[model samples]
Target: MQKSVFLGALTVAGLAAGASAAATLDDVKARGTLNCGVTTGLAGFAAPDANGEWEGFDVAVCRAVAAAVLGDPTAVEFVPTTGKTRFTALASGEIDMLARNTTWTFTRDVDLKFEFAGINYYDGQGFIVPRALGVSSAMELDGATVCIQTGTTTELNLADFFRKNNMNYEPVPIETNAEALQQYNAGACDAYTTDASGLAASRATFENPGDHVILPEIISKEPLGPLVRHGDNQWGEIVRWTLNALIAAEEYGVTSANIEELSNGTDSPEINRMLGTEGNLGEMFGLDADWAKRAIMAEGNYGGIFAKNIGENTPIGLARGLNAQWTEGGLLYAPPFR
Candidate 1:
């Protein structure tokens, strides 16, 4: 009786979820576009290019998903959202998926009712200060004015870290990274705190990038990723597997240059399965067989996206330290496609 009751409850939950998200895939197909939520002008993450085209690491994910679903990389409506507005935009169905640098946490996952598909970037909050400030460590910033983004985990983390360290700070709250950057540049705050990657990305945009120094003390573990509202399993699965396809494409040596040839056939059965040469995995997901191929060919793989946007060659100059492939001593490992 207990087992049957549990199974019955699960069925009801599944049915509810199905009803909620059954229209997402169809709506996206009918509308002929994917609405993706992104940050409000964060360089190397989701900023517009010289031609006003959205281009960056996070933007690449949106493009890939659009290609996978609509068979066109350009079929995306990039919705710029501030930290305060991103969740509401996604939950209200104003956006299909959120690719902004949002941290996944317990309150967000359970209380707010969103599903984090996977970790796109593993980051930690840190502080940045002008070299002229003469502060070498975060411990010395007692009573300092700190610029922080509102409606983010960074704010909570900042409060906890200061209280735990027996330090105090005056928070200069802002809604977007651009505002925080302006305040930090104008000396409105003695220090600016955010994800270490964000600090670096922001600093790279300044006129004198070398003047700002990121402190070595990283205070919080921020697992940043794309998320969708709860009760949207089918829509969630499309976003999840689309990300997995990018990671898997990197793992299996599939590049945009040779993807066409590999799609025809490959000696490795796993590669063939992922590229849709020898399996109908797409059928299981209610998508065509060329979905993964379209996604990969739209941009390259996960590594390609990172390198092109924020890698060492870029102004952001982030190393593939924690984001490298699992075989290369990093944590980016995708599940088996089969």
Candidate 2:
């Protein structure tokens, strides 16, 4: 009958929608590359090296994900996205995930139809001014020209901070961190405002890094992370657990140097499950048993990545304050592998 055919058609449509919802993983496997969105260029976060090889903290996440899914850490297309273009790139499927210094906010999470995989960096908005400017505090910047990245949480936070202090300032909006650096260096803006970690990265690139000082006040909490499109729960879980694997690896003392040895077997059940020596954890996410192992091996553990790229010895010189493991009195704690 016509009614029976209509019911069957509805069932078929539902099945098709479900399939499409989980399509990213299969698409990525077929393509053999993970398109990862990152910042245009931020020192110690994401940027090309002397030989034009992409290398940095955020870049490592992209490489790790590619290794987990594609079995090759180098199988990644790093799409450079500014503050405005990053979201659109991810939404349009131009990129599989965004690993830029994007903050996890209420509207961005709920209204933007994106799922934040996890917080990679706990950050806060702050300001930097040249030491010659004699501005020791953010409150002293009333009526100053502030260079801020457009389409970011810093825009609103800058407004709120000034408003709270009964201050007013001229906004000098820039699209990228590089532009902000240019404008601020050229005296187009009196101060540059962004995440504190970003300020450190920027200052490290300055000709006279000692000539500038980041203000003491941190205005807004920026829980920066990687994000994927919302509908693909399977893909989201893969990315989420990939990052968790790195964190847990660091917590359990599994470094790149030791990961292979540990993978042979370990005393800890959690380590065994994570490294695929025990349990079907990777199969649960439709991947091979060695997915997490590949991810960990690709970039070393999260702690290793941090220490190499942005730690005190690096140009960025960011101390592991809030980003340290929970057992080390920091905010990082991953779920059990089992």
Candidate 3:
């Protein structure tokens, strides 16, 4: 009986130690600012403006989380990271969360020991060649010199695409989007390959956007979103559900303009619960009742962010194909807040 009691006490202490070690909320709150890892410079995704302020679709995710956690959207220190350095920055605790447009893959999730909070953008890899190259399709480019970013799935995808098509190409390895674009424009590379959305974002920054054509072929799945380090379930939940809150807000007809009114109280129980008008869901996540309300107000709803930043109305001119809400026949859906 004495041995059994000792073992039970040890088990309880172990569990308590594990729980204490997982308290990301406490750590972030004490830090007073969220360290967000973002792309070095992707125009519609995450980039610093002339005044050094970060803005774009991906940056909005960071701001939303900041609003949720620190009650201030602008209370974020945006750390620019390259494809090669992003994982190391997150793993080493240089950044609290990564809101870059990174793909969620098995190797990245398991091998890299990162938790993919959710898929905010469903994309695919593609090639962009200058229209003058006379390449109507990706397969038409034989013996092409491709400018591709290193440490990205694009590198392997480019190799596989060429091998499967029985084509030969030279790789001009570049480190960042800016470098790849420079090499492609300077005639050092015949084509550029990356996520289709990235291709569009890059093209939008060109002096003559119409001079480039993104090939019709989309190669690999790129479910891109925010990510946090593994073994921190609490931090993972904050990032994951923050993204879901944005998506859910859009689906439930919640907008930044109406969010303040709705927060007071809503007849829709789901909306009320989500906005913290009807439940203590925020308490469960170690946040105040107005956490999600602040998040939504930070950058508007998911749809609003898309349209204002990278949608068809914007210079990026990306149509919401697969990224549309599930209610509208796309894949964007979030679990109920309750």
**How do all the candidates rank in terms of lDDT, highest first?**
2, 1, 3
For model 3, where is the 10-residue window of minimal lDDT?
Answer: 16-25
Question: How displaced is residue 38 in candidate 2, in Å?
Answer: 0.3
* Residues 37-130, model 3: lDDT tens digits: 9999998899988998999999999999999999999999999999999999998888999988899988999998899999989999999999
Question: lDDT of each prediction vs. the true structure?
Answer: 0.93, 0.94, 0.92
Task: State the lDDT of candidate 2 residue by residue for 179-217, as single tens digits.
Answer: 999999999999999999999999999999999999999
For residues 129-244, write the lDDT of model 1, one tens digit per residue: 99999999999999999999999999999999999999999999999999999999999999999999999999999999989899999999999999988877777888898999
Per-candidate TM-score against the hidden true structure: 0.96, 0.95, 0.94
| Top-TM-score structure, candidate number | 1
- Residue 303, candidate 3: Cα error in Å is 0.2
